[model samples]
Structures are given as C-alpha cells and as structure tokens.
Target: MAFASGSRADRPNIVLVVADDQGWGDVGYQGHPVLKTPHLDEAARSGLRFERFYAQAPVCSPTRATLLTGRHPNRMGVFTWGYPIRPQEITLAKLLREAGYATGHFGKWHLGSVYRASPVHPGRMGFERWVSSPNFFDNNPIFSDEGTAVPFQGESSVVTVQVALEWIRKQAEAGRPFFAMICFGSPHAPHQAAEEDRALYLDQPPALREFYGEITGIDRAFGMLRQALAELGIRENTILWYTSDNGALPKVGSTGGFRGNKGQIYEGGLLVPTFLEWPAKIRTPRVTRVRCCSADIFPTILEIVGIEPPANLPLDGISLVPVIEGKWERRPVPLGFWHYPAPGISTPSAKWMAELLAAQQKGEDLPPDGPSQRAGQLPDPPYPSDQFPGHAAWIEGDWKLHRIETAKGKIRWELYNLEEDPAESTDRAAEEPERLGAMQKRLEAWLRSVVQSLNGADYAGLGESPSLPESKSR
Candidate 1:
C-alpha cells in the first residue's frame, strides 16, 4: 500500500534520536555479540534500515549542527567540537516552527552553550522547550532546563527520553504536531551505566563491560520511548530517525570492518547505523543501500511537511523522500565532507557548562568560557584562502575520493570504488586517472562554495546581525 498522502495535518511528527559515539556495528542487529540493543535491533528490523548511511562529520558538535541546519558544519564555522553555530543561519526548528509544528530538544546539546542568554542556545535555535546538557553526561546529570540548570535523576538516556515524552504528551493532548530531538550521550568516553545494565557485561573486560552497559542502557531507554509513542497513538504518524553523531571510539566500538575510526574521513569514521520508522508511510520493512547523510534530515522533514526553504538559500542536503518511497535509486547530488584542522575545546566535564548556565541566571559577570558567560567562538581566517588545507572527501555513488593534507604541508589524493572496496584498502587513483581528475575538480569547487558560506554568504538579507567571536585555534 502507498504511504499516507493527504493534507498538512496528515504529515508525520518527526523525532530525531542521535547517539554520541555509537558505531556502525555497535547494535545487536549489526551482529555485535557483546552489546545488548534489542530495542534498536527491533527498530532496524521494522523500519527502513540504511546500510550505507553516514554522519556529515565524524564528531559530535559538527554533525549535530548539520542535522539541524541541513548545511555543512563548516559553513557556520562549526569545524570541530564545542564550536558554536552562527545565529543567522536558518535551522530546521525555525523552519518547522513557521510551518506550525511545536518543537522541543532533549539530552546532550553540544552545539553551543545551553545557557538561555547565549545567542546560539537551543531556545534561540528554534526549540520552544529544551532540557539539554552542554556536553556528555553520565548518570543523574544536571541539565539546563530551558536555560536554567536543574538536576535530573536516572541514567542519562532514560532521563532524556522521559523529559522528551513529557513534552510530546503535552503536544499530543493539545492536538498539535511536534518535533522532538533526542540526542543520547551514551557509549561515549567515560562510560557510565546503571548497576543493572553493567551487570549484563560483568564477564567481559573491565572497560568493555562498562561501554557495553551504557549502550544497553540507551537501548532500554529507546524502547521506553517507542512504547510511549504507541500508547499515545502517535506512532502511526510519527517519523522516528535514529543514528549516531559519529563513528566508534577506538578499542571499545566496532566499525564493521571499515577503514579508520572516529576523527578520520574514512568510511568507518563517516559511516553510521541509521534507521527510520514511519508507520503511516513505511508500511513494509526494508533495507536501503542508498548513501544518505545527517544533513539530509532538514530537507526530508521539509518535504514531508510541504515546506520550501527560503529562496536563494544554498542547502547541502537534498530531500530523501523519493528514496524513502523507493522511486529514486541513486543519490542525485554528491556529498562533501571536510575535517578542518583544529582541536576542539576541552572542558573539565559536563559540570563546567552547567555551572556557566547557573552563573548566567545570577546576572554575574564572567569571561566567555567562565560561569557567567558560556559562548563558544568560531574562527575568522585572516583571508579567505584558495587552499583547501585539510582532509576532505567527496562521495558520488560508489566512488569515493579523498584529499589528505600531511603535516609537512603536502597534499595527497586517493580514490576508491566503495562497491569493490568497502574497506577502502586499494587506492584506484592510478587506474582511474580521468575519473579521479573530474572528482578533484568537483571537490575543489565544492570547497570554494563552503568557504564562501563561512564568510557569511548564506545569511544575505536575513536582517539578523552577525556575531563574530574572537578566534582561537589549538
């Protein structure tokens, strides 16, 4: 049967649940023997599981920025972790809000400060309500409740889902459509799990035991969320998207035999497990091999709600609605990724940002990174350079091209047919000379466009004043 096709009210409610560092093979459905993820496994079996989905970038903040804005993270100068997104850039929440959908955010919000006064906080980003952490947190986290830090009980994922469900229930009771972004901080570093969850992996090594337990905790929490949706009777018309922000961590996470781990531009770093469940639209369960990215979320949601982006805006993502309906087989537009060379800001822990938010409420004066003010800064290059001085890649169909910058300031190019080399072991650059040359030109042009955006081209005529913070590179 065809998916629902009707008025705007028939449109599905969208929920995006992102994991911090869950790997491509971390779930039970992906053949992980140690980790217990029955809820995610069931979702994969009952939905459209993306076999070749990728995160826009191989990190937390940048990928999250892409998920909301449907633009490359670098466009708004969010090149690394803890970098803030530009306030002027349009966000998915704002777009959906204008379309008459209520929006809320829960869990880890590493994109910027959770403090209410920050220009790029979740509230300013279009989420009407939010309970977010500045970064990753463990059990019993202190969350910024719409800009005020408050203590929450329970494991991280469980706490996040509970708050989200509360907001969702409120919307459903009021007969209003809603969008909820649930970002989990599980399976990241400093793995912490409830005693019961950890007990499931006690036989394993100490480190692996804790890591697997955290994932199990996330699985249980997700199952609770799915149940809530069904009981609320919104499951039939809700679009639920689940995936990680990036690839796996070293030693603890699995990349499913792909090359490289987190922080690289390789398949392992970029590729992540993704599943979408829309009971009203996707009547049958299936797996799709089409390449998709986190950036595609914005356009996909827009297509579902029959909303068009502002004219003259350049979106890096194309709508995947056709792909979902099984009409479009191949990706129409090439995807680009660049890891700009820089180190992300390192805080002592989640408490640092929580304290900052608390300080802001007191109306005290503090430095940008201190308790009173918690704004992150983006880079302002001396001049827009012609050189693409970083590791970058462009994927078109099964062909993947890579440009790596060496420490000695040298550039190297590598090409691979991903269909024949999922591991990216063989460099076909020598044999496919003409094809490689064409891809290089396309990549260079794409990089040039991104540079233009970094310099504030997309915000033309938005009338919002720009906030250019002081630049600091590590």
Candidate 2:
C-alpha cells in the first residue's frame, strides 16, 4: 500500500495522529495478543516505522512542548505534566501556514487552556480551526470548539477521531492544503469503552480486556481516518504520523521489555511507538533503528514544508527529514532528559494511583488543577535554581547518566553504556570509574546549557501568554 513515487514539491497534506497512554506493544505489529491495530499496522507496512523513537519526556506536557517547539521541553520551562508551552514558542502549524497551508488541530490540546486572559488558543498557536479539549476525557465529553465548550457523544477514542474527520472533510471541500493533529485519549485511567468494543476482547482478563478494548476502539477509527483520506484523494500525498504521547501504563501492555513504564526517565518510560506514512515521497517500506525524539519532529516538519529555521535559536534536535527519506545519518546533538526535582505522582505505582482514582470514582472527589490551566502569570518558584532535585538525565551517543540528589547531600550518580546494554540493567559507575566520570562532566555541561536556555538566553524572554480577545477562564 506504500505510495510508489512522488516529491515534497507536490505539497502534500499532513496528518499527525497522536495516541494518549498507548504502550509500546499495544498493536498487532508489536506482538500484543489482544490489541488489534489494523490501520496502524497497514500504515507501518506502507511507510517507515521507527522501532526506537522516544517522547521528549516521560510525561505528557513536556513531550508535547517539545513537539511544538523543536527544542527540549525543559529548556522551554515545561518540566512536568500540565505545564504551559511558554506562549512565545514557535509551532509547526504557524510555520506551515506561511506556505499557504490551512492549518488546524483537533483533539486533545493539553498545552494551556487560558493564560493571562489571552487569546493564545489554537488559532494563536498557528492553527486556523481547532476543536480541542484541555486534556483527556471520557464518553459524552464537553470540549472547546475554537472557544465555546460543546458537548459530543460517543466513546472517547471514536469521538476524538470523528471530530477530526468532520474537520478534514470541510478542508477537503475547500481545496485547502491542510495539517491536522489528532490527539486521542484512550486506555488512560478510569478505563472506558463501549460494550461492543469491550466485547471484541472479552476473552481476556478484566483489566487486560478493558485495555485492549480501548485500544481496538481507537484502531477502528484510525482505519476510518485513512479511508476518508483515500476517498478524498489526499491519502497518497499526506505525511501521516502515528505515535503515542509516552509509554504504556503497565500490565495493560508491555513497554517492550524496557526498564520502566511511563513517568520515569528510564528507556521504557520515554520510548514510544512512531511511524510515518507518505504514499507520494516514501518509496520502499522501511524500518528505522536510529533513535529519534519528539523534539526532532518540529524541525523535520519545518524542513519538509520549506520553512527556514531561525539560526539564532539553539535547537536540541536536528532535522529528521533526511532520516525519514531513507538517508542514513544519525543525529549528533545531545538528547536531554530532566524529570525535575519535584516529586509528582505518576501512574502504575502499585494500587496507590488506582486507589486515588477509585476514591474519586466513588464521588469523594478532589478537584483537579495545574499551573497551565491557572489564569495569569501566576507566582514564580520560592526555591533558588540549585534547590530543585528529583532526577536529571543526559544521553550522548550510547552513554546515559542518572543523577539523584538527597535532601541534604551531594548528588549520587549512575552511568550505563546504552550501546552495550540498552536496558540499563547494570550501573557501571563503580566498575568503570573513568567512563562514568567523563560522562558526568558531559552531563553537567549539558545541564548548564539547559539552565541557560530556561533563563531565556536563547530568545531573551520573548514568549509569554498573549492576551485573549475574550477570557475563557471564569
């Protein structure tokens, strides 16, 4: 099904489909027993499948920040989930629109809802027409369509795709070249799926069955998305990307035998499923073993769409357009990982998270809030730059280092040669002190650079929440 021939000069439409909480092996090609991802499977067979792509962070907002800016999330001040994208950043839709493309984003937009009474919504973020939710939602959800929160019925996954389909059809009829981002929130938390979707995998255990059912529900809609594109004659030229926000939620599906699940700096936590389909440009069906991260996406898309990147802006990710075009050149830049010094609760921590969720389900509810959703500039941190310390990591070549700081002590260190051991099973700090020492110095240097970036050394404090035409936050 791969497109036999074509070129970027043809100005193909683009569709970036992102799945929330989907694991590494939660599909047919990855060898999951219950999950059935026919559309994604066929897309993989029809295009380039990246076997070792990673999210920019182990959590959501940070990785998404990377997606929009082509820079490390931490560098842009998105150190955790639900953080704002620093309104000053450059986005793909905005850049692509410079080329006469009609840009839109439909589905989950966990970036920032309303900040500083500003109109920095999707349209301000470079998207022309946006029907988005602040974050993940269940069936019969209420979401913001451009500004108004509207109610929609159906399973969350199906509803997510259905909304995007409607938008795509409109764009097609207008003969506009489009770039759409479809964010699906499924198999995350309080698992919900339609009875028919659940029945599709009723043979499995309760948890596994529910997990698989949610995935299958999304899979069917993904197939429909492809079909709709083909019927519109846009499938062949579109560079359709399919990937997850992060890794699995554990037990639901394997993180492909990597160390940790989601919400950790470990390979398993950050690694995710990634594939690119373009019937026009991609010739042979292929698989990439090279490591790629979410930050690289921005630069790659800009290059593909012929936008000249700012030379003054330092980007941690190189353009991946060459790699996607069957070229063989590895990215030479450093890949950064910062889990922040703050200890936030992430999922799959035994029954602790489950218990919190269960209690809320029982109606003893705790209101959810985060910094990004809070209106205005808000307050800055009380601690100095040095006080924060959960964990920080840096990956250069095949070497990886993890730094752990105690409440009142010098930070401890651990190192691993990922080339020799990808799973990071053994800490070679004690065994090979010199290699460890060298990596520690490099990691520190990278950290200093990160600190500089965070302080706005790059853009000089230019990006901030724009004043919205109307305050959506009440």
Candidate 3:
C-alpha cells in the first residue's frame, strides 16, 4: 500500500468525536422529535451521512477499541466495557503521532487505567496530551491529567471540548496536522445535565428530562467545537467525523424503532448515527446507504493521511476511501460482531478519580499494583478453539446471520434480511435454508479465527497471544 499522496502537507486534520450511550434516533436529523441538534442536522445536510453505520460491538470499550485499532476487540481481548486495550496492538493515535501528527485524547478513556504508570494509559498509548476519565463522568468531574487528578468545573461535555480546543488551537497556530479523539461522557447512566439544558426538556419525565438535556449539552459543545474550527481557519481541511460509542440506554434512550438496545447483538444495539465533514474533499452533500462500521475509521484515516499500517497486524476493517469519494455502492467485505460472555470490569471514573485526588492531597501514593494498573495483564492462554460461546453476528450486504449459544450450550441460528426488515422482527432462516447454511459456515469460521486470535494466534511471538488463520477476514 503506497501512501495516498506522499506528502504530509496533503493530510487533513482529523477529529473523531464520539458520544456515550447515544442512539440512532438521538439526533435531530435522524427524526428525533424532541432533541434539538441544529448543528448536527446542518452537518448531515452539508456532508456525508451514513444510513447504516455500525459500532463494532454493542458496548462502549469494545467499540472504542475498534475505532482506535481497526481490529476486532476480541482479537485484543477487549470483549466488554472497561477492558483495557492490549499494549501489543498499534493504535491510530500511535500511528498518526509517528507520522508527525499532533495527537491528543480528551474525555472518557475507558480502555485502560488513566494513572501515569499504567501501561495502557492514553499517554503510553500514543496521546501526546490527555485529560481523560476512566469511565463515564458527571458535571464538575475530576479527570486524570497525565496521571495527576485535576478537578475541572462546569458541565462535563463543555469541559471536554474546552480542553481539546486549547490543544487544537495550539496545533493550528503551529501549522501542524492534528488528530484529536474527543469522547464525551454524557447521556450515559445517571444522566446529569446542566441546569439550563435541563430546563429545555421539562415537559418530559424527570429522568428523561435529564437524559434529553445531556444530549442538548452535547449539541451545544459540538457547536462550540465547529465554531472554533472555523475561527481557526482550519474547518475546510479538517475531517470532522461524529458517531456514538454504542446503542441507546435501555429506558431513557431511543433506538429509532430498531429492535434490541445496548449490550445486545441486534440492529438497535449496533446501528449508530454517523457523518463526516471535510469541505476540501466532500464538496457536495451526500447520503450513503452502504453499511459501514467504526472499525473502518482507522483504515480510512490511515488512507486519507497517507500512512501505511504495520504489515503484520491484521485489521478487521477496510478503508472506506471509495465510499467517502462517492465511488462505492456496496461494502467489499462482511462485518463481524461478537459479544463474548465475559463480565465487565467496573471502572467508575468519578469515584476513582476522587479517591486519587484525595490521596494526592493527603500526600499518600497509591500502590502501582492496584486493579486499575494491572488491567492489561493477559489471561492464561490455550483458550478453547473448538467452543465459541456467546452471541455473534455476521453481516454481508443486507443479510445478517446470528449464531447464538444458549446457557445450556445449544447453538441456535437466525437470519434476517436487514434491508427488508431493519427491526429484525422476522426470521428468514427456515425459509432460506441454503443462505442460512452458507452464512452459518462463514460466521463459524470467523468465530474460530477470533478464538485463535484470543488464544495468542495473531501475536505470533509478540506476547503470549494466539495466532489467527490466514483465511481470516481482515
């Protein structure tokens, strides 16, 4: 793979903005009757809007891992929320930094410990600077500033944007291409919106009022970010991509009529609202129905910036350069999603940071061998390659095949033609036995490849990681 243009000057500034727990129907352009997202609506009208964008997994940490690595989370053992990204994997931030891009990460960094010594902290993961939280945070949150706990005032979303803008502005002044990952910690559980934002949604139930308000706050912060970009004169060449980490919350979130919610292997849990704006490249507004996933973001960005990925690393995502250029009508490969049966590590950002802040203030240092610091430790290898347990889905074009393993170890298969039934209300497995059989075989093969990777296949001798088969999808 040759570099896209061969000049660093040709690379555009990239900003990946992710929302926590936001759903497909949460934005105004997506037909949300209540949420007022004027800025997002405008971006959709003026840029490339994706009708079928998916998160690699139905949870936050896994999806975030895919966005950063372009590889399936399972390949690195990030099976659920709060799991740290394996240190052996190369991240987009690390690659971009190596390519002379100023990289910064702001807001939630649930992939690993935020402490300075943690092997998987943003600083060690290639972020030149970061003000990050270990998990979802609330207003007046305390964040880890390169391992030092610092309390920030005002709304969490506002604080995140402000911190990121400060760094972005400096990069603009220095005339350097920058990649900023702004992950907002709002609209998640225990939604706590700013007072003024909450007032706009008083008509809704109390809980929903806060949830809607949090979304509104995100909208305001996003508007501020866009305005800042224009003021800096970098808006035209900046590729501003926006999407959520996962599906909606169970009660207070909307799935846009899709079946299932967060943490499930259904349309509602996977599908997300996504769009990109880069006036220098995307001069005309376009809407693409072609299916895409968060994993594609890594390769697409690498292609756009003319950076070559590491040769030995296998990517579950393919570059979407053709789609962005309006030359692609369909995806070239199937998308695989698996929810391995593993309990999530509890990583409460506010509580942990508060404790750190208190400890620092008291002149006490916490031990380095704490659970947070040891998050990246690998489990014993030799995982069962024969038995693939959990809910897994394989999507090719409009057809989706689900391979589910019941607690009793029975395997059940269901097929859905998503184009005809986006809700997944009807099963087509019995009616289309041949198609089901073929998809099942492919899905199972992919699952085995994932298992192989989990058993240290992909790593070769990098660590104790397993190897993946050569025929595995990249």
Candidate 4:
C-alpha cells in the first residue's frame, strides 16, 4: 500500500458528497427564499464553511475530473459535459484504495459510460465498488450495478444515499477505514421529486415546484447520511465534505447575486457552496472567505493521510489542511479557470450500455475498447498549446482577468475587481493597465503548463503515457 500503515485513529474515514447543479443560494443557510436545504444548512453551521469556494469548472464533468486528479480538467481533456475522463489520469478512489482504504462510489457516474469493459468505467477508474447511473437520472431510476442495469426504488437522492450508507455500514462493521463518494443526480434536469417533497413547495410557483422539491429531497437524503454516521459512532473522526459541482442554472438557479450562470467563466458560474466537517480536527464552526477550489480536495486528502503524491504528476491546487487547522489565512496561489471551447463527445444510451454488459456476461466477443468506444478517438501525437483554444481567467486576490477569443479570431481582454464588485458589473481593463498586464502574463503561463500536460508531458516518467486513444479527445 502506498500509505504507511499506522494506528486506526491515524487513518480517518472520508465521505465526499456532491450535488449536481446545486448553487450557492440553493441552501437555506445562504438565505434562499424558497429552497429548504436543512441538512446542508446544518452542515454549514457545524463545519468549516467556505465563503468563496469554487468549482474548477462551470460544468459537471470538468469539475469532477479536477476533484479526483488535483489538476485542471482541461489538462486531462475533460472540457465539458458528456465527456469521459482520460483513463491515464490518477483518481482519488484509486489513491485511497491503494492506501488500504475501502472505496466505493454511489449515484451518478457521469465521468464515463457505466457499460462493462469500458476503460473509463467507475470500476476501471479505481472505484472498488460502484452503483452508478450513466448520467443524471430521475426518481426510481435504473442504475448500472457494477455495469449491469438494475432497477432502484424511491427518490433519486434518497436512493443514492441509501446505497452509499449500506456500503459504509459494512466497512464500518469490518473496522476498515473507507472513502465514499455520493454524487446525487437530483436537481439536475427534468427536475423530478417525490409527491410528498413537491407538496412542501405548494406555495411556490408551479414552474419552480419540482425544482425546489428536488433540492429538498437532496437535503433529506444528506441528513440521513449524516445521521447514519452518528448512529454508527463514527461521526467525529470521519471527514465529511459537501459541495455542488458548479454554479446555478440561470433563472431557475440562484448564484447569490454574482454575474453569469453555468457554462460562463464569471464568478456566479464557478463559485459554489462548500463545507468540511471533521469533528476530530475542527472543533470550531466558522466561515472563511479564503478562496479555494475543487482541485484542492485531492491534495487535502493526501495531507490528511500523511502521504506524498507521486512526484511526476503536477497538481494545480494546494492543501487546505492548514486552513482546517486555523494556521493559514490567505491562499498562497491564485485559482485559474479555462473553459476550452470544445464540444464533448457523446456516449451510448443507457439501453445500449445495458446490452453491451449482457453480451459481456454471456462471454460474447466485444470490441477491446468496449461499448461507447466511438465517442472519443484521439489523433496522432505532437499535441501543441495552440491547438488548445479557450477563454481563460486568473483570479489573484480580488482581481480577475478574462481572456476571450471571438469567433472572428479577435482577442478581447476584460478585468474585474471581484472584491469591489462581486457581480462583475464593471470591467476595469482600461482603468488598470499594470495589474491587467501582470494577470494576463500569469494566465498565459498557466495555460502553457496545462497544455504540456494535455500533450502527455506530465506522465512522461510515470510508466504510463497520458495519451488516451479512445478518450481525452476533448
């Protein structure tokens, strides 16, 4: 095992819960007028709440990719939704499993097709056990049970949590340290909630009833999971982390008065609610305005386990351990975001994925790349920086710089003082020349580093090349 074995107390259990498309104002603690997120609100009050936490990307797949690898999504070619993470990139599950931790993933697994034999399937991606759906699913959805379609009962969020709780209980009974990631599909699309949950929003507008109810269901499920930890007598030592994948979804979603919505590089699109509860480590519950991103999660885990990351891999995020211990205040490094203007490759439908799994179970000959193999097929090597096009940004303290390339091939620069104008209402590109120049230089340099990783530079001496022939085409 990679992690040096130690006392049971030295290896803390970790639970990471992610909500799909939930926003900063989705929880009642953030002062949302209609949404009832009691469980999340309680979490914020009893934990270290992050006032300025950000998702690495403004989309699901990209932020998720970063959460596992500690590198920017674009580096691994996960540009947008409907894309699979390149198999070469390291994942948190794999890391934890190697460290003698029981790891399981439950709920939505949008990183790749859940079909059997797919190289990027949750199991192949390092998850020891996974009960997952191909993408966002509604109530009573059919899940890929370790690559076989199985019907599940009850609300989407509730079912996901129940599945995760079952695995957690077994690990707890075995006295084994474990890592569980519960990715809820509720409040994503086709916003569907149970009839009882929808009844709570009867006074809400008919159009928003389902959406609000979905959030409530998520809150209920979250509350159940937390309560389970307490009942299992494993609440204090376990680190429970909660956050959304990205920002709000425009009108129906609330961004807490920031500018832009999902898919945009604006503050509203990237910033999301975040909280970390480790009763054994953090005794005081307080909120901090220090800027942090999803990329930091992987490094933070390594720090908690007292393990060093592989030297060859480059991480874009720093550990938040100091912050948790109240030894750090300001973030030493600025956060960078680049939404490469690239369309994500589409995977096969759920039906086709199920059919492929059945063929595998019957000993049928299938393609080596498995089902959904046609989604991504990379070209020959020599991938250069110029080929990676995108609108990039760099956030240093309060200052933010945006670089946009128009369809006409014209470059435009815009700067914003986020501390003064959190909404990004004013552009200070012309007013602040020196600051703009410095930020632009930093942004470009960061992009160059990311490009090198995209070209398989980071994996050079790691024994495995980063090239993904049937993936990473993003």
Off by over 4 Å in 3: 1-3, 368-372, 461-474
Q: Which ten residues in a row have the lowest lDDT in candidate 2?
A: 465-474
Whole-model lDDT, model 3: 0.87
12, model 4: CA deviation in Å? 0.9
Query: Per-candidate TM vs. native?
Result: 0.93, 0.86, 0.95, 0.92
Compared with the true structure, what per-residue lDDT tens digits does model 3 show for residues 129-189?
Answer: 8889999899999998878899999988999999999989998998888999999998888
Model 2 lDDT tens row, 99-194: 667777777777766212233457677777777766666667665666544568888778877888887888787777788888877767667777
- lDDT tens digits, residues 55-95, model 1? 99988889999999899998888888887777777788878
The CA lDDT of each predicted structure is: 0.83, 0.72, 0.87, 0.82
Sort all candidates by TM-score, best to worst: 3, 1, 4, 2
User: How many Å off is the CA of 130 in candidate 4?
Assistant: 0.7
lDDT of 4 by residue, 117-148 (tens): 67787777777878888778888877777766
87 Cα displacement, candidate 4 (Å) = 1.2
Name the runs in model 4 displaced over 4 angstroms.
Answer: 1-5, 347-381, 465-474
Query: Is candidate 2 or 3 superior in TM-score?
Result: 3
Q: Which candidate is the best by TM-score?
A: 3
All candidates: CA RMSD (Å): 4.6, 6.1, 4.9, 4.4
